[model samples]
Structure formats: structure tokens, C-alpha cells
Target: MRAFKGFRKDLTCLGFQFREDKINRTEEANCVKNGFHCAENPLDCFHYYSDWRNSVYYEVDAGGDLDEDAVDSKISCTEMRLIRRLSLEQMLFEAAVYMVEHPKRQWNYGVKKETGTACNGYGVVRGKNPRAAGEKGDFLLILKEEQNSPEIEEIALINIDGKRWHPHKFYDAYGK
Candidate 1:
């Protein structure tokens, strides 16, 4: 059996808009002024994946001790389909509205070191409103937690590549 690796935290990506004039302000302050900061440096937003699916062609390479003639005999190809995941775009629009309506709204990551483990997550907050295509007014904010930190109390495994594995088990048997 392979050695068991503990839970790996998700890579957090934040997306938000920024103003042309206020680009010099600190990210935390901008997030706070725009009502995206839930508390302090932690952004007050959620990242969601879109349901739209996209397809792409993938090539596989069989690396082994094969002769030159044998290696050129066959072709390996596959199709991979992925959902158009939502990260910052939607969050920016929503956060902008949220800040407008609730200027004092506190958006903060709820994870704490005292919670017995390290909680990893990604978030995006809007720093400004949207403008014309060529105009630069909106901002895309991103935040990422460290990988392989501590374990959270309740962990939900995400099926990113279409294969499902036991959350608590070593996946050495996969792709066999």
C-alpha cells in the first residue's frame, strides 16, 4: 500500500474589479471599501463553478522502452470535457451590488487557526463596478489558501477530473 497523504486543500482564486484612480490602495482596504471584505484580509465572497460544459481534444503519450518503429505505429487521442467554471466574473458583479446595498457588510473567511486545523479556500471580491469593454474600471480580485496545510473538521472531496476517489484512502489503484 502507498503512504497515505492527508487532505489537500483547494487552490483559491479571487476575481474582482478595480477603479482607475484607486489602484494604489491596499487590496484589503479596497475590499473593505467595496464591501467585499468579510473581515480583515479574508474576502467576503464565494467561488462557484458554472454548469456550462466545454470539450477539448487531448493527446496521450505512452512513454516506455519501445523501439522507434513501434513507437510510431499507433496514435493516442482522447476528448476531455470540462464545465465552464465560474470564479471571479460572477462574484465581481454580485459583490459590487452587495457593497452598494450593504456598504458596511463584512465579508470574511470563517476559518481560524484555533479551529483545530487549517482551512483552505479561494475567494473573489469586486472592487469596483463594471464599465465599457475598452474602459478599465472593474477589478478582479483573487485569494488562495496554502496547499496541504491542516485538515478541516468536515472535508468534502471535489471530483474535478471526472473520477471519484475515497476521500480518506490512498488512490494508488486509480488509472490502472
Candidate 2:
């Protein structure tokens, strides 16, 4: 799939605060690792990295057939960019949990349960049986061409909520 090149500059994250002490060597190194120069303004730090398409391609469940045991699937670059933007924006604004849908029948993302007008109905509840259409995993993002390693796995598994669920466990349980 082609990489998403455009990032909506207007979609700046609002109300983000940076810690003064956290801006030390480790933070600077992380900034460099994420492809940015550490700026004096904390807003610059947030703005620079806020673009979802900056350094990684987010992995999604992309719900598959019930007969087979897989939900991981590829999404279009456009959909990826939008989902990233939405996730970051929602994370910053509402601080709520968000889940991205696998691209089986369609591509979309939503918050688990939201009272805010903007975040309502971003997700659906599951029945006794798990379905790809309703699979909502953590807001995991993977680096492009990331080699297999524990470090890579840890980095890819980003927690989007207080509670966490691995997509694989669902398939493993139901596939049996």
C-alpha cells in the first residue's frame, strides 16, 4: 500500500501541556528518533509528532472470515491518516478510549463509550460471540518495516484506555 503523505496541519492538538523536567536528554533522543528536532516551545513538540503518518503505519484487526483465525488487515493510506488524526485529536480533547475497525467490510474508528456529542457511537458492543465487525483492540501502531522483536512489539502495542485487550486472544478463543 502507498504511504499517506498528507497531514492536516489545521488539526493541531489543543490543550496539550509538556513537563519542563521531562524535556531532558531522553525526551530529546525520543524526539530525534521520531523524526523531529526538539523545539524550545513545547507546542512544537506536540505539533511535530501529532501527525499520525509521521513515522509509523498503524496495525488494525481488519476483521477476517469466521472460518479462518485472523483479523489483522491492511487499510488504505487515506483511511489510515484519518484514523490517526481522529485518534490523536480525541485522545487530546476528551482523553477517552478509541478503537479502530479492521477493514474487512469497511474502514472506521470510534470511542468505546462517549457522552460528548463528537464521540458518541464511535464503537459497538459485542455479543456472546466475537465478530470481526465489532473487534476493538488497543490503539496500536506499528513502524513501517518493523523487524520482529520484543522491543518492536512493546512499541507497537500502545494503550488507548485504562483496560486493554489483545486482538489475538479473541481469534484464538473463537477459532478453537
Return the top candidate by lDDT: 2
lDDT of 1 by residue, 36-78 (tens): 2221111222212221122111111212121211211121112
Q: Give lDDT per model, in order.
A: 0.22, 0.23
Per-residue accuracy of model 2 over 1-176 as CA lDDT, tens digit each:
21111223443222322122221111111211222122221112233354444422211111111111122121211111122322443332222111121111221222111111112212222222222211243342221111332111111223234345433232211221
- In terms of TM-score, the best-performing candidate is 1
Clashes of each: 20, 3
RMSD in angstroms between candidate 1 and the native structure over all alpha carbons:
23.7
**What TM-score does each of the candidates earn?**
0.19, 0.17
Which residue runs does candidate 1 get wrong by more than 4 Å?
1-88, 110-139, 142-176
RMSD of each: 23.7, 17.7
